[model samples]
Target: MTARFHTLGLGAFGLGALALSACASQGGEAPRMAQADEGEIVLMIGLDGLRADFIDLYDAPNLQALAARGVRAEAMIPVMPSVTFVNFYSLATGLYPESHGLVTNAPYDREFDTVFENGVSTQEERWWGGEPIWITAERQGVRSGVMFWVGSETQIDGQHASDWSVYEHEKPYDERVETVLSWFDRPASEQPRFAAVYFDRVDTVAHREGPEHPLVAEAVADVDARVGALVAGLEARGLLERTNIIVVSDHGMTEIDPDNAIALDTIIDFDTVFVPEMEGRGGAGHRPFAMVYGEPDAIDAAYAALDGAHEHMRVWRRGETPEDYHFNHETRGPDLFVLADTGWSLTAPSLWSRGYPPYPGVHGYDNHHPDMAATFVAAGPMFENGVTVPAFENVNVHAVIACGLGIEPAETEADPATVERLTGGRCPAP
Candidate 1:
């Protein structure tokens, strides 16, 4: 509604974005625990690195069935530099990366000197500048659960969710689904009215095997099966009719050829700027993008040095970045953004002097690139049946979930009209 998407592409989305799949079924004011007798529930399931087109390409009947009955975005547009931590937080807070202060993963926050890493950075609430749904839900007198959603492990607003789980990357999919479903088995008062679970195997495996590899397909099926399990478990508990399911992937996957590596050492003036985390993974330079930090004079010189150094990589200065990017935070945003072209790696040659172990998959490209588009689907009493809504930004997800929970969303940049349509006007625009 408020400038929904600057660039709408039929590229990776193909004809599916245009087709209409209509279903006729109606229900009450959806997902509002404030009113329902059985206490309607809302489940937010996050699947990492699942391309918007993967469901159609691979065998994912369970997700397809849900979409056949509910709302599916043509593709979910992630905020700029479309990486994991940034977009997931954007989805949770309804803010761009700049507004949320998580411009990129593992940056040197000038004020705090903290690099946003999974283990070290997640504990500090200062790194995150917005209110996540669980915290907002709790404040509004509703119980919420989080099974390892980003920022869930930390005390966002002075407390954890009513129920929460620590992250275990190798945890089995069925176990995670069971963990989410198990929350419902609690007594009516103890159960979470809203909940979230994250799965990363697809993104992990794809990073190694690329999007087309059979292993990625296997991962997709594994996630699809978990969706089936969650649905069945809810039905067995007679909560299926009351639960609204919203599924999303942080960002899509794109394959990077080993030869596509763009060595920053060749272009960047090392004295002028340095990457914050140069010790981990042997300093691979954060793959596909790097946030460079330096003094003003140094940043100016470094920007001049790297300008037009390569055709494959693009350099965006703090103030001169594209409007759609919404980049440029004082502390979290870098002096310069060195973004590799889609399917290329932004790395320093020194780290891989030994050998380049191929990582066929990567993201964090330009947000509007079709390959970077993520997936979105919602099926429940609160959503319209059988529809493919126009593509919208993931930021709107925060408000939509808040609306389903019947709570006022925190201050965010989500377009009210976008959230209204996605939630079938359960929380309409003022």
Candidate 2:
């Protein structure tokens, strides 16, 4: 079946066109997978917007089998904003969004005087910072391949993944799987030790059909089928036993009531304040949180307009954001943050004028909310079988993958305890 995809900047197939162009400009050739001294392979699969509990909610026998045979986390806590690009980079770098500098999927950088929007803008490497695990592995002479993982397109720190696909939604899932298998077929000296594959249909279905809709269950099953195929292929190649397969998602989805959306214009007089780099309304990416930019006085008014407008939403200055979020870093943070309560979203007045239909589901709520938790399951030589580990932050995943692939983990914010829990006390660093 052909997967229908939305055009959201964060998880949409619309960016695939731009990604194709970028790849063509970069010579349109796959990078040579450099072999690592250790033959151990690590495959990191990201199922975007996978709810933490959905694995059990749906008939995903493959995922169930994975959990039964390998270490599975009770929950995977995502970073603040609980958005796509934010947590994807966080997971890749083992750092919070504030540290990595890709705070939002569509962050506006004041220094560069640009916005890192969902599509073409992400192609700019300047928008990315912090060393991703693939870059770390590449630096250590290990080949890494990324199948459309966030931030894989750009030339970060003057390097790209050894092998990667330009984003293209038209590419069938089976084709993606075949491409991954082909990577392993390379000579040992050119085999990638660390590889990542991403799937967006589950998240897409969640956004259009709500997380609780029956369609989501079907989507989960489809993804599970893909996972099963991947495992089967690895086993066929005699690589399953040696490969560390870590399946994860950046964040989860929540149902959004169409009538519960708060319009920004009704709350704040746009004439009084300038809100730039704002998404939602009719925009592709809509969620529970929005980034508002304006002068200091204007920011105060924007905050006041929505402070009591909705019981489910809250507004704050970027610095005033909760410390637990770790979002108060020095780059492109919004002057004002407006966060909708769970299952709520902030929209534009124009949307109301146009009779805009609310998204069936959305995310970007407080990371601490259970609704925002993602998925984490690992099965491979590096993991202890049948172990259910306690929840850990997504930032610690990079270190775990690095350890599995025998690459030295870069200095990161991952707590020692978090690593120990995931690695069964076999963490490489103290």
Candidate 3:
């Protein structure tokens, strides 16, 4: 396997220098598709913000049953900048955020000199770089479908799923399942071999009510019920035997005290460094984490200005970042990353002026943090029954699904053993 990460000046830069070269390769020999007898349809469902322990915390009989029947990982670790878009794209492409280019939910891309926001940015295809599994499936002569996934709505590598829809959140969960069921109703030749569905209610509610809030439990139940409905619908159509149900989450949420906000003004002087004001948009990155893109020459001064500025926030220079997080994107990312301590947040002065309260729950913390671990479970024909795997990165999810579909995975940072364990050595050629 080719080395995907290139670390430069590790010892010379110490813990503060940025150590990234460029995005990883976008090509590799596609995996050999599985034979008809070995091929298994995969349906990956992303339950946003569902923690690894939420299944046990809430009364989710359907999820518990799914875990009992098939394999459930103790936890699924999210990639760095443990936010929605980064990890979701990671799960889709089997690449880290550095490789996929959806580094954060909102990020400033210097290449295009554009700030990628939620709605306006998603439509731009250049923002998405990696080859998602949908495209990989198409390459191997297999059909794929997606309902409201990160990259599914836009074309990646000049192609997207054979069947897909623009993301619609207001639609009820059951209606979405019915839409998926409609796809299954197609003749065997036209049915999708691999599909994906995304559910955000749990994450939405959790962010408002906190993960431990009663509303979060209710949201978990609602999603579990939705999962049950999907399974039941498949069973009614006699598709359960052939389809593998892979349930996962983008990233877990953590409760934050509204009063524990760290104002950026208190940390660094805006006059000394380049304040991250992009086209009148002043806020840096999302809360719980903030990225500061400053004058290249003033980086040391900027680093010194914010270093130990707040006890709750840690400042990382370009090369000083942890190699494990893979967030050293000097070109695409900020020069300095100010990560709020878990359970805390970094806010802008404008928020206080406008009286915007801190969010009850948030993510985007270091992926290794305990509170950021997401869930993973697999059941049906392809996965081993009643087996449990150790914690693995969400990037491996695409590989697991690719293995089930019997197609070569695109270039990924996931471990090969994860795909092996998830498929129980049933996966075909790599």
By lDDT, who's the top model here? 1
TM-score of 3: 0.88
| Runs of candidate 2 exceeding 4 Å displacement | 1-38, 276-286, 351-355
Q: Give candidate 1's whole-model lDDT.
A: 0.78
lDDT of 3 by residue, 1-430 (tens): 1228311111221221222222221223222222334346789888999999999999999999998989999999998899888888889988876677876776777767667766667877878877888888788777898999998878775687889987777988988888887786665566787888999998999888888999899999999999999888777665677678999998899998867877786656666554333123534323777767757767777788779887888988765677777756545667888888898877666433244455688898889887899999899877888999999888777777766665666777767666677777764224
lDDT of 1 by residue, 217-306 (tens): 899999998888998877767678768899999999888878877778777666557675343544664388887888889888888878
- TM-score for each of the candidates: 0.89, 0.88, 0.88
lDDT of 3: 0.76
Worst 10 residues of 2 by lDDT: 17-26
Model 3: how far residue 356 lies from native, Å: 2.3
lDDT for predicted candidate 2 compared with the true structure:
0.76
The residue-by-residue lDDT of candidate 2 on 89-174, one tens digit each, is 88998888777787777777778766666668667887887789999888877779999888898888779999976789768888
Tell how far residue 413 is off in model 3, in angstroms. Answer: 1.2
lDDT for each candidate structure:
0.78, 0.76, 0.76
